[model samples]
Target: MAPPAGPGATAAPDAAMRALSSFRRRRLAMRGAAPPAWLISLATVTIALVAWIAATQAGLVKPLFLPRPGSVIGAFSNALDGRIDGAPLLDHVLASLMRVVAAFVLAALVGIPVGLATGLNPTLRAALDPFIEFYRPLPPLAYLPLVIIWFGIGETSKILLIFLACFAPVALAARAGVSAASVDQVNAARALGASRVQVVRHVVLPAALPDILVGLRIGMGVGWTTLVAAEMVAASTGIGQMVLNASNFLRTDIVVMGILLIGALAGAFEFGMRRLERRLTPWKGKV
Candidate 1:
């Protein structure tokens, strides 16, 4: 064994550590100068609004292409009062919301089970993977004609299109997340006298919950993205239909209004899902 170091050596190392700690504190202080996320978001929004107003109000962009904020607001008011088209804004909003919610719920109800089963059984996954992979990458618009021909240009076709868009993401996410449940955990559960069903219900699901929630969020987004295409199916009262009508009439303000409304609604739903994910998976992202 070596003898202990003298005070001089210890003093040098202690000074170096103290200097490193000071450097870290200084770096943290520097980082503290950055604004909070919400504040940055607000600032970004403010800048965008200012830019939009300046571009439109100062005639940098044509009203035909990009209407002024005031024009859009007036269009919004007219929509609210049912002055733009025969139907009121509430009708359009409700129609779109109903279609999206129906499709998303159906996708979750079907896809989640299939996904779980696929994860639990390699044979099932092998059997299903080909079909899922073949169609998942196809754009919704590509099959719109086939769906219309099969289901007719009715609400059924619209919801089915949206459902197809949502189903793949949810199913794939669930399948991927199933691996998060380790073999050790499964074995442990079995050793504890847990039934197969109990092992899955208690162990697999909790571990996979985060991925499932992520899939739901992604599926919701895809459903909304397909909403416009789905609403193209002889729809008369949905927001997508309203936007189509506005475009035909060269009503740029109304088109902008519809786009903004769709974005706001989607954003609201996304925020709600994030909150739900946090609530249900409090153990997520922790050590």
Candidate 2:
């Protein structure tokens, strides 16, 4: 209804939009590039370390609260040599790893099948959905006391805590993966003389594996974080206990070292899971 814009006005707006679009494209490209990922990660760690060093040297933060990097290194050395708590750090790491392995393996065995069944059967889902939904949102700390009271302060209790923390994620992930299976593929398998069980085993499971792996990763993370709370029950020889013990004495360095060790272990698990996912689900998203 109005007069047409002048060439000059249209050109300026068009140029500005083009520039913005180009900038966005470049940013996205940079993010998607693998080389930049490592570079940025390294740069981020370097910046954090430098800032921490600066803060410590400038005495902006007390050593008792946040020890220097060198102090943490020394604490790590002591832990390795069995000088801290008169136990080798590897012993603590192994103890924690054992609990995680036990809980995670059990969760996978039970949760995966239950998840797959629920995905295939609406009746089963209706029956079990409320139970999973009710507890999934609750944190480990919320139910930890009840668990300890029921099971007593023992290894069983600790493992059970970790199990509870890991179960919901793995089950939900497997179920979601099942849902993601192509209906066409399922029907084709049925038409090709595949039984219900065979169709699920061959078609649905393979299709859902990528999602199941993702759920396992999340479950592992939850289990790892729940370690601290789990070890709170009559614990003596795990990273969580080590951190808690050091905190009692204001041993900030040891606490920080323990935290780093936990982070490293968790990161290692995540990396390994990602590799396993790629290898096991080569056909992911291809269908």
Candidate 3:
């Protein structure tokens, strides 16, 4: 190459080159040796709390908008002492859980079988797909009025609303699971002298289970989301009701606490469902 650059150019380039190399090595080290998932999760929570504390201390965010963590904790303590709303916090949580479990069971009882039938029979799929597709995208709020009008402001209406919220996801998941089943497995079962029902019961159901569990997880999530809307009816005892009742009085601390409680419960449900899936479908993704 040419002779060495002037002293100024030479110095600048040498420093820049060293800096770039160090940057790249640091990046590679970090990227190649990622922390475990739990560590990452913990880091995320820590970062959020640190940010929250900073914002609260700096007064950048209004208490009305985002209550302080200490305020939320105090609200939680109050809830524990049975002063959150008209009833104890556990009563509200229990009421919401009862509604969720009842609605989920209803959806599973109906939607899973219907979904299985739709995938098993081309005719049924053709007949039901349109109806399922139409309602699947509709939000729970849109149909709550009709549900309330028909069913009155009873617990039945609330349960039905959550049930509908859960139904389409569960049904569609089961249908997808059945569709994803191996044609080879079905053919082999038939070849081995299994009857149609037996093949469906044994070959198809097992193949579709993992997906069905996934759908159940999704359905349960939707059911929880629908809870607030469902409890909009003339209701008094539910986590959703507590949130709404708190917001009516501008109790941001209570609102934030309720939101966190709901989020924690949802995460727990998701974790439990994942465990159940692993236990039941241990052969997932295997050839």
Greater-lDDT candidate between 2 and 3 = 3
Q: Report the error of model 3 at residue 249, Å.
A: 1.4
Cα error of candidate 1 at position 141, Å = 0.6
- lDDT agreement with native, every candidate: 0.95, 0.92, 0.93
lDDT of 3 by residue, 15-126 (tens): 9999999999999999889988999999999999999999987999999999999999999999977887858889999999999999999999999999999989999999
Q: Decide which is better by lDDT, 1 or 3.
A: 1
Candidate 2's residue-wise lDDT over 16-135, tens digit each? Answer: 999999999999988677576778899999999999999999999999888999999999999999999878989999999999889999889989998888988999999999999999
Please tell me which model should have the higher TM-score, number 2 or number 3: 3
After superposition, the stretches of candidate 2 with alpha carbons farther than 4 Å from their true spots are 1-35, 285-287
Candidate 3 local distance difference test against the native: 0.93
In model 3, the clashing pairs are: none
> Which residues of candidate 1, in runs, are more than 4 Å off?
1-16
lDDT of 1 by residue, 1-287 (tens): 99898999889999999999999999999889988999999999999999999999889999999999999999999999899889889999999999999999999999998999999999999999999999999999999999999999889999999999999999999998899999999999999999989988999988889999999999999998999899876888999989988999999999999999999999999999999999999988994
